[model samples]
Target: MRGYPGRFDPLIYYGKLRLNQTIITKRLTPIKVDRGSRSATATLPRIQPRIIGATYLMIALLADIGGTKSQLALMNEQGAFIHRRTVLNHEHPSFDALVDQFLHTQPPPQCAILAVAGPVDDGIRCRMTNLNWLIDGVALQQRLQLKFVNLLNDLQATAWSMTDPGVQSRLGMLRGSGLNFEQPVVVISPGTGLGQACIQPHQDQYVIQGTEGGHKTIAPFNRLSAELILQHWQQYDYPPSWENWFSGSGFSRLFQTMFPGAPVPDNATMGQQAISDPDSSSARCMELFTQAIYAEAGNLVLQYLAWGGVIVAGGIPPKLGKLFCQPEHIAYIERKNEYLDRLSAVPVALCQEADAPLTGAATYCKQRWHESS
Candidate 1:
């Protein structure tokens, strides 16, 4: 079997030995039956040892770490859901505290993959933007008695989870010809911040590349957008980036900018007011948010040439999917592009699944296990 270099040794583990034995025995067992007083024992065919090995390899520890809450799941090799749980990270003092709570309740997994809303390298160290936690993959593995550990940017895992056939049902389609699975896929998610990535096509496989492109300055396509951004630049002492008007916080800031004398509504009131009136100040803020998202999607589509499709995943887009589906939003998206005709050929899909990031983490672990075997 293929192995991860410089990681845990499967042969030296007793739990793996027992798991292997259990799988092998199950494969070899047969049953006896009697039909009309005629009894016969049937011999079950011998199963491939690799198949047993693969089954044993199936079990993995997966976590989807988000800004407010974190989700953990234990999954088998076939991507079957086992045990799932969620914890509020804000209540936990540190990452260790959160991991400790999960370990106390769940069985120790053979291998682990953690998906975090931050950049990751070498599948080890990670720094989350919203939480006061610094995670070390190796340390968590050692403490939890894991064989190997992998880390992925949250959006990268979301892109990976998109490979599952079931994801199609949750996706609300937008303009485009259709999906060409063979081509590279692009992911753009708007939440606390914007997340972008491309699922590059490999021979009979795909690789997701996460990027911090959300931080890139957003070039305003209209005078209104330009004025809104420039206004914030004065206060922030930084350029008005896409994130300023594209995120939840950005929406509030934009509302305050558009109607400075209006009462500063709390988060709840702002959301409620926006829903109440699409033309209200709150609604105007949301309009800009949608526009920024559409603009970014177009930019990424052109940059990646994502003929496969562009997927919108995150808390915001799915809830506002209907609004985004409107003709004005679609037309606004097409208007900003110099190559509108070419870009129009690319399809855009929205992922409605709330726990997509968690599913992606599990899928990532499964793919790694399969490749190793």
Candidate 2:
């Protein structure tokens, strides 16, 4: 009732494990259910592997909260994934409600690592860029009785997966000569909003840094892109930021403005349609969007000198299919006037996994555990 009407619903499970009703594997512990007026209580099934000489095994909870959906995963101290659950973000009244509903049916984790679609405040709080929700690490820790709770900008967490060997195997190269691990890595995600981050190895570990590059001033690549920016200015009374042209809402808005019809109401549908029907206006919209993405990514590469590589994550890139490989798109990415030679050396790749943020959060938790040990 607290959330938007018709959008809010009872917590729905989308993973292999269930509450007391369904039985999982031998590792699953018995469920303890607690009833509450506002939300039900359940403990996360104790699926931790036994460790000799260790009195207790460490269990981690990873949450990647985005605008459209949230991915939840459980992992062990050793960084082995246990299970994952995807829930629509709007279905729950609040993030706390969603977590409560989840733990209400299962056991709670000792440490909770969350990757959210916003800037984190000292790893303790976040105000989502797209969702009308405020996430507090301190509050979540107390509410869940968690030993540790931390928040990371979605891209900051996704940066961890940039170096993951398994994640690398799934990447689709778009441009650049090759990757060099010695250089810093950059990650750009255009989903509900735009997210950017840089990761560099230091002292036997990676130091992840968040960036507001997505919110920076956007430069149009051509006259058509210039007109789109002018239109955006007319409507908003300010220059459109990179996210305005690089995000889902931006995709639909740009398409409708250019085509003068409401063919598609959202970016997800429009993107999917563009893939299936290459001749449609949706395709044109996506092409323009890709160009903007390329330009912004190139700018980041030049600004940060991220010669290691640039990884594109979130919901858009994967859907673009082989579009990045097209000569025009590749040319746009390498069109830095004076820095063409330097930029051409930078690699660009799409993160093929939809759960890269979840994997990143799990990796973050694992690293923290070891550093503290």
Candidate 3:
């Protein structure tokens, strides 16, 4: 793909100002930091001196590309965050356009790791499931003339962030049960669409496997849910997949079915109503939505035997933190027929930090180039 025509302009600044660049900087657009998570502006500890060698100043560029927006960050090999920027996906015609925009305004990094919202094939090609875009790491690397480019499934990137100190510090316990690090870790994120991934510990490192589990038909937990599934089935040839009822579109569908007489609003409008008015019909829809999600979370835990833990990530879950972490929801998730005890032992937690996927992409870059630094 051809990059948008532009000369490198140093005047336009899109990202956060560097720590050393300005004493008091103003953000062009404020990023809403998650209240439950540690502040991004927290004072960083001093970096230790390297023995008999100068510290590498080379930075790695990281990108978390999703359906709605793309978050980009710059960090040193030492894993210190330098700056970040957010670009709405619609702002660029293609993925290449977005990358070109960033590259034009900033000095190119040694390498880049991009966490995209679809499976990265063996050839490093990913056709975004929710957006009309194709991303090929090899092609992008050649076009940018970067030393290296790594592609990771967005959920795979979120999975990797579990090991990041910043992510770990922000995790608030939903289910207080202890986690067995020896077992596999699974992350289920429901955003514009549903995404599920599992990370298993290998000999010395972890292996992340992104799953199309979201496309699998979901078995209803109750008679009403079963009927709803049937309704969804009647409307489409395909079976009611997890994604059909667990994402933003899912929320809209549920709201429509429950209140057919009312004007069917979009997912964003419904979400605002639910969050603002507890007694509203939207809130009732959210209650059912919460139940369905909890049931699915339990199924994932059992399906993968993810005793290492179950992490609920994405834009939705963390926003409904109060609803997600309710004791009743955990109780519902833990209600497997014979495996209730097994499920109970698997900790369920909300990923408070929204930058988790971006951070995870940075982690991959850090691992690959830390020794060089």
Candidate 4:
């Protein structure tokens, strides 16, 4: 994996691919206005700033900001992955501290596009749901001396990566009658949290958009499942959302709910036990987690009309691919639709690759760089 050629030239390799750069730049453009002087007359662009150095080597920094771990990579303008590293969020007290450590060991890039785990405002301020940190885009750019900086939702990064060749290596192929590039694609990932995004054709290019659909109220198909979720929520006073059932920690909650009196181990301990002993209760928890994930995937497919198909990419699904591939799990997915004839026609697949987010981020940055250059 370390020896792989990571970068590509869009002009040489993807000139005919019809890449979408307009949405990215338009979304990332800074809103011009005075910071302290709120008067309309003072809204003009600041005039005294001197010009910076010309023709700095264009490099892209891609970061995956997840709940448990954050992965960062540096790619050159030519699309080659030059450096890659991962850091545990638990080890850092703040987001700035993590960035400081990352930059201390590896130099900052010219341009940076980070896939954060939450929504990004126009000014680039973001708040990760599972992690305790506030990310300020303007501050980060000024501190790192970056020419360009853009922030995207992590699921959107996964969606953009679907078009890359590297993603093909990790995506399991499924042939279905209705699957086509012209149709929308839905991506549902289950990890520390449940994430959803959609990719749709926008004019000559595709737009990958994020949705907080995971937090939507989960309507159970069966009375037993409904009662179980409701009871768990009632007992814990937690919201009855898809993330409460589809995520890794959600598994432990569900398991404890089901077993009631069984000893509940923490996520790391449970993972270790599950790996060492497949027959442990930890494994059972994972099995149930996969079931909920499949159910959510089916829901997203119907809601999005993802005829381009559904792709499951996350730390959880890929780790438990074999468990997800079981007959019962597959049956559960197929059983959700009364319109089986129509649903069976749609392609459903899993993404087993680890570096999909990184690849997607690289692709996004390269496209933007080409458009601006």
Candidate 5:
């Protein structure tokens, strides 16, 4: 990727022209036909990075790691998928083993971006909340012999996915038109865990900030909801969180609390049963679950001051899409006493695309590749 005079240079990777510097950038090669000594010492100028395409070049390793499974892919600077692989987390002893198997026959990527289901420290280290895996980006880069590596919270990766052009078509709008859309949107995902990320749309781009907002104490809208929270607290002797009341485990706990003697089906099955029998206990529980999710999303909108909107995304939303999109439930999301009008005005959409974090990791990688040092 060689840059020309008076043109965009993002595609071209460059190393600084320094005097007697020993540093070497990846994908750089030099050759000399002769013992070529024009002066007292040999000298070199900046070198162009290896290019694969006319404009969109840079290939990178992108990964989306979750509690139950993981997805890895090779993506280009233009956000095109070259190849992807999915693996169960439990099947592999560690992240290193899984990544090694995936990259066995693949070219060593210049950069790697990993989205883990946990809190990342300084975008480098993460201790997975559901799985027993501690990932360190710097350590991974050394082991893989890559030039750069970045780690992101899985939800943050999902937030980044929204930036991909293809994702817009997969979105299902639930509320306001795009007219009121603004900066600082928030994503609320309920699945294996309640994942949240605040996306601040900047000038022609967006920035994602991962948060553990799911662990924040649950806020009830009324006395019945307050009672439900109390019962949830009693189960663990700790205050209930959005994760405790709205995630996969949350649905199970709520169903069990409602029906102690009857069989408790999996969350997916429960959703099916609710759809089949709207008057059953499963339906009541689903109503509670969906309503709780809406409330929490509103709470997040307020917490983050996200006037842009709310994107409800996760494994569960698409499954319960029928119940999730009920217009009657919109009130639950706009119940804020003081900010009711503002909350209602914000656009709300449910992202239907699967494997969002992979696309997001690609978006993050391409951004990093283009904005060179």
Candidate 6:
């Protein structure tokens, strides 16, 4: 069956008062209001707040669609997620089928916000980078009778994740301190591929700009890094990119580059070995990966003028743990002679929340829904 029987126009209930569209609350916490001033403030009680005119609440389907897995959830305007679930991409026959199954027992979402692991071509359709699936926003909007559907580059979603306090709480400072939110912020995520995005403050909201910085020409931070580039160039018949030595595939690729004749383990196993066995080749590979990450982050910080901060997200960094907190990692970022002070002053943080992308999608959806309302 089609996931929905008819168009969904969410109905909201707040105690005895029934609102038409929006549910306004901060982090799902009860909101208190000054009825005379017609303003709201965060409070502890679940008192019924006066809403002006029709309330504008929308329940959105949020999906972090990646090559290996997809995290699906329904997020209300209060920024609370319900029924979050992760499903293997391959286990489902198609993305549409996967969404249908996920929504099988739930009411159809009013809108859908999808974060996809690929470039959003024409701001609508996306062809998965490492999979055969294709996500089309317009098609989904029609099929589900949704108000709107938006596709974001996965990195764009990760950048927006900072809007959620749940994500902010898990952020571990790798280096530097103090955050200046007035300036731009950047996010670099290395998983199946390298992703980059920047968040620019606009009035009271934020504008997320996706970047293809990962595909930029590679610059060797050191001699060994230079040698790997040559190795990749010789074998692949093209100059290497930052993603070559910076992403999840970097583990296996680095292992192969170091030991030409040895069979390389899978990326996960190599990452574990890097953490557990310091003297092994895996650790050495991780070392290079760490340096590349720092080096590129420095470049991005300078390029974006991201004094707000640089957030390092994705599946790989969290697994590296304190391995990334080493001072040597920041050394790569601070190698800039003139800008060392500026780069050093910018806080570099590690995002530990695995559901960061989903949170981001929810934030994006909520913002768009408000705009529409």
lDDT of model 2 at position 176: 58
Clashes of each: 1, 10, 0, 2, 0, 5
- TM-scores of all candidate predictions against the true structure: 0.83, 0.78, 0.78, 0.74, 0.82, 0.83
lDDT per residue as tens, model 4, 114-213: 8888877873788987788888878888987776678888877888788675565556754443335578888888877788988886765677878888
Off by over 4 Å in 4: 1-57, 88-108, 174-179, 233-239, 268-284
Question: Could you tell me the TM-score of candidate 1?
Answer: 0.83
User: Stretches of candidate 6 above 4 Å error?
Assistant: 1-57, 231-236
Over the stretch 168-262, how does candidate 5's per-residue lDDT look in tens digits?
Answer: 66777888765222478889998888898888877767778788888898888756678877776677777877787678878877777667668
lDDT per model vs. reference: 0.73, 0.74, 0.73, 0.69, 0.77, 0.78
Tens-digit lDDT track of model 3 for 196-224? 88878776566777777888888887677
Write down the worst ten-residue block by lDDT for model 2: 1-10
- Candidate 4 residue 64 Cα shift, in angstroms, is 2.1
Pairs of colliding residues, candidate 4: 7-79, 7-80
Deviation in Å, model 5, residue 141 alpha carbon: 1.0
lDDT of 6 by residue, 1-373 (tens): 0111113332333322223444444223555655575876643323243223433234679999988899999875566775789999999988999999998987568889899988898767999988899888899989988988999988888888886666777788777664556889888888778888888989889899898999998888888988878878787867777886679766666678878888898887887888889998888888888888888988888888888888888888888876788887767876776688777788888888777788898888878876775
lDDT of 1 by residue, 1-373 (tens): 2222212222423223334335223233455755667987754333234324334344577889988889988775557766778988888898888777776755457788889988786778898877768989989888877767889999888888887777766677876645666887788888778889898878877888889888899788677888877777787877866776677667666667878878877656766666778877777767667777877887887788777777888778765665777657755556654888766677778787888888888777777876664
Alpha-carbon runs more than 4 Å astray in model 1: 1-57, 233-237
Worst 10 residues of 4 by lDDT: 1-10
